[model samples]
Target: MIRTVLVALPLIVFAIAGLLAPLLSPYDPTSGDLAAGLQPPSVDHLLGTDQLGRDQLSRLLHGAQISLAVTAAVLALSLTVGVVAGAVAGYLGGRIDRVISRVIDMAISLPGMLVALAVIGVRGPGVVNLVIAMSLWAWSPYARIARAKVAGMRDSPHLDALRLLGAGPVRVIGKHLLPPALGPCLVYASTDVGAIVLGVATLSFLGLGVPPPFAEWGQMLIEGRPFLASTWWLAYPPGIAITAVVFASNLLGERLAGGDERPSILRWILPARRDRTVCAKDDVVLRVQDLSVGYPRRVVADVSYEVRRGEVLAVVGESGSGKSTSVLAPFGLLDPTAVVTGSIGHTKRVGVVFQDNLAVFNPLRTIGSHVDEAVRNAGRRPVRRVSEELLALVGLPAVARSYPHELSGGMRQRVQIAIALAGEPELLIADEPTSALDVTVQAQLLDLLARLRDELSMAMIVVSHDLAVVSRLADNVAVMYAGRIVESGPLLTVINSPAHPYTRGLLDAVPRPGAAPGTRFRTMPGRGGAGPDDSAGCAFAPRCPIAVPACGQGRPVLDVVTAGHRSACPEEGV
Candidate 1:
């Protein structure tokens, strides 16, 4: 609390000065004494006099009124307009949301100064004109922040409950949605105050803000610039005032947003290391060796795999087995907190398809636009033509005009595949692509993937918990348990003659061909998710049905059980 107060002190002081400039200032700021012009500090004028003979102290106090008043006006107008529009758009999604979002994006992309210059250029500068100019560009950031916040809450349970209680849209939004959205907006507004103040000063510096005889910080600086050498007091005072306010506003905002903790500057300054440590064979499309990922704790360790040209390596595991982490960390796709270390060698570009197509896509953007962006990123020319071709390749042609929310789950997944294929990648990684779809759609997608693989001769990595799903797609399979690959080999070899108990349990869980109706499916006894470093011995030892005392004694390394097949069971005895 004390730290926050200290951070806020400068702005508080400036606000007080601006609000009480009449009481604080000793003389009329605009009236000047020509005879006493450019005088140094004295008992009568403690801050000295400007070239126009205006009291520096009185001008500064009045300047604070002009600068901060414009800042306050701009901030209030922008915040109100931005927050209301954003909340309404987010609540009533679809075309309204898309249009508002597009406008926000355009506004944010436009240079704020340029927008202000354009507005002020059209209408001659004054306080009202200056406020309007700055408000135009300033509103977009608040709108974006509010839209994101409100969008996340649009489908929440509280909103649903309110709707059930016969609450109208206005009450629901103005009372509930806007209040929470205003919290973050206020934090952002705190920082934005500094920018608005600086902008006002800059425009005045360029002679586009308050006219002559007006006491503005920017006007004072411009007036003082010519006399900077003779009177250091002229420039330094307002400059110091501007610097102090900006610094204080930023610190206050940071405190409100994340408390006292500040992020490491080195994190932004230093570049990420992309050093490739190993090479793969020409036939090998990808070689991942000793890959480990953690959120400061080892979740995946010493994971290794290879995908050769025209081959599919399916990583089979239950939920939380680190299959997704192991694949995504190599490509820098995990959360920023994740610590990834290891070597991943791939010869060419890789494309990825994630499950949950709804989450993968922007609801505001059309499917075609998404594909076109990916296509453009891959250096493909004639973006529309190539994007259409890729969409047609994935059996989703002519859906370019459709938004993500408009498409069915199956069609959305197909669009995701098309986006992935936009790169014409040599290797494709699909993370549970068919998990959420129906059996029919799932089969169709798997067939489409297999056909694409054969046609393009691209290597693939398919991560799945259902071994049955990958049975028709994978050429080879790796079974993971507790962040370690317990068994791996050719699909048929591991499927028919699994050596590891966990693998056997997974195979048992799959619905067998001759199962009677109403039969209960096989299930493992204990839950399976454990990190690699959670135990001194094997992570899967606790859940292994056939485990002995020796099973938990030490970590078991994969040993060759047959030609092109391996199992990480100590019972195998290498």
Candidate 2:
């Protein structure tokens, strides 16, 4: 409430003063009485008299008229020139962009205030000259902003579709580019409004403003300057007015821009992964070797693992350790730009249960609708019958008519499993399946998956960050770091005795009730790996507590420590 009052109060006061100037004050501002010279603000005048004994209140009120007029005119003119120039330059690149950009560079190079001074000095300082001088360089920033906006939208699929549908330059700019760009462009323009007012006031105070007796705030300041000792009222009010208006516009501009700094959805979509195809020599349900995902930067690399019939292998890691990248390849969901090396071998049907069930299930469709569609798409049984059977199998028969949003998180996930099962897959990949559920619900889901795995004799690959989930259900574990699997072995063997430094660090970082009362919780000292950019060395070397000189020399390949157990490090300890 206080903020609203602060922002609105000045606006209301100035607007009314400018609009109702004539009626608000009875005295004629220009024709002051010599007999009442230097009157200390009484019934006749509210603020006090200036050096000329003019009614200060009346003059201040009228001064707003020029201030507002110049501000509005300058804004309109600058925006027109800037937005148009910037849009043309950015949208149509090549020679046109270069030429316009150079011109903008030149315009900004000549200081605006200096140019204004020269123009006003020659034109003999007045409202018209002041407006023209201030406007000369104002439009350049707006144009540059607009052009950048247009360039960003150039490769947008929707815009390309519009062009393919025969959109002209006018249609594209007016309908598509300008509207979205306007939000930020106007934000830039609004910030300049405050500066423009200050600039005008500054020029006026220095004697280049509208001539005396015109009732301008800057001229008022000059008139009040000599009375600094006894009368502070002379200089203070105009200064306060200028400060208020400029400060208010800055706050208003920030509000107008609607600041939201989240990443765009387009950033999520990259080039689909290209596979290198590593053919497995042994007979297995799924085999992937030498897999790396991306260009410019790789998220996951040197990945090699296999899943046998009825085997449950869990790929575990921290959030960005490439857990999702490792599992997503079998479903063919990796970005097109991602460079996926190593072949993924799977002969039978593959069923996938995604992490976010709310996003996976259509809000408009009922639980049964999805099941029915999946069953029908497979061409096996009647939609109603097969869907009902699948639903019953996953313990969601009562939710057949319920929409996805109507069900709880766990229930929605169960429905997703039922849909996946409709394909009768030999291999099922559940990515972060139990991460979003409560303890009770998670246990139930895990038991359900275990039951399903046993009943169907299915091979499963589960991807998760929660070591608890991995420990409970996985037959074997693949510990991932910086996109590569640093360790793999039987679940009990990996948990009871982790082989890699990263695997040990991950286990140590988890909080436990078994610690001493004053024991501080543990954390990995550095980032787990070489990050997305460093491609030459062992990713975990920087954070590895036992790291030696040889660790950073080159990438380490996985070596067998025991019969089925493996570790990527070449250290002495097995």
Candidate 3:
């Protein structure tokens, strides 16, 4: 917060001075005495007088007011027109998108100064004309940015769901779409402020901006240019002012775009500590101790687990239960917003297979390129040979020449697996690997994974919301609720005789094999997962069926129910 304020200080001061220029300036900027002409800095005029004997300080103040007003006007006009046009084009993609995109490209391709000059030349130079000229080219860049953002989100499932619920184009765009699109546009606008200010000054310097007698920064610079050697005060102050605002504006944009985890500076200042605890066993491939990850707010808290050679550890929970966060945190896969504090001791070489292969594999690149790149990154020689072998090993043949989009979803997943295997990793992590596939495809992937695990003797961590999905692969199970591990033990022991209420609920929710045809699966009351710190007691207390008043009093810790089995529920014994 302090950092943000510090970054914005210059703009803040400039704005304040511009808004209160009349009250602040001691002498009228336009009215000047010939006797005071060419005077240097003194008590009467702090910044000295211009060639017209005008107070430099007063002129600067009023120049700020004019400059700021024009900048704000340009930004408002450009942002609104550009964002609206771009969003409409992106959302209603077809001939309209292509046309708008072409226009945006042409405008951007044209030199900005030339475009401005052309508009001012035809319209005649004035404050309004200058604004129109700058805005004509300026709005195009903003439109392009907004259009790209909206285009990416146009086909999202969220939009489909909104449309299903009878939402019209306006509400969908205004409420769901425009808000996210506006973020990037505003970030761009921060930097654009400097450009607009500079442009205004440049045009005014060329006598194309706010008419004569007006106290403009560019006008002052032009008027004082001839007297540069004698009266340095006139030009230096305005130049410094412009430079300061530009530098500050650029810095502010960077700050806004980067947020908390700025890789350029913040990462170096406070690096992520990877303090791994040494494992006693030589075969222990992965060990996580007290893993806690947060986005400033605690999400995954004090979770610990380990995977030995040839062993599989399954992290299972509902959405937002921190299942993915806990597993992915060790690999540094979470977004920069995440603040991970934990010790993860793992093999030097680790491979990961994400849930959505479509997202994982670049659509533009051929399957061969991705695999070859991975092979190269793993420090292997003969990239083509290694990539082909990896692809074959994953049961894919002749697919090296094909692009990611040309293949089926399952085929794409196999390609992802092939890419993961390129590293020949000692440990492999799959996060919801089969969540999006059909039953048959999911079974095939799981079987393939099992075969790989057995053949390679590699440790694995599989994350999923479904207990049944991980049953085929995982030897040990760790059930997470909120951000903490609620139950953990051998998969058979936990699944057959679950000690925690949440675990039992999850099991009950799964469809039984021999249940009556009309039987409905049980659903736990209340929401599934929340932040660990959201409640002083158990996060699942509201949803737990066998909850007692005591369950709401304090948080429960894992207690040994049987050998290798533990439950967080204090009432498990009862």
- Give the clash count for each candidate: 0, 10, 0
State the local distance difference test value for candidate 2: 0.78
Native-to-model Cα distance after best TM-score fit, residue 77 in candidate 1, in Å:
23
Model 1, 124-146: lDDT tens digits are 89989999999999999899889
Tens digit of per-residue lDDT, candidate 2, span 437-519: 89899999988899876666667899888777767789999988887888999998888888887888778767776788888
Error of 2 at 466 (Å): 28
Candidates 2 and 3, the one with greater lDDT: 3
Candidate 2, clashing residue pairs?
Answer: 271-335, 271-336, 271-337, 272-335, 272-336, 272-337, 278-343, 294-339, 300-483, 529-539
RMSD of each: 18.6, 18.6, 20.3
Output the number of the TM-score-best candidate. 1
**lDDT over C-alpha atoms for residue 5 of model 1:** 94
**Deviation of model 2 at 357, angstroms:** 38
Better structure of 1 and 2 per lDDT: 1
What lDDT does each candidate get?
Answer: 0.86, 0.78, 0.86
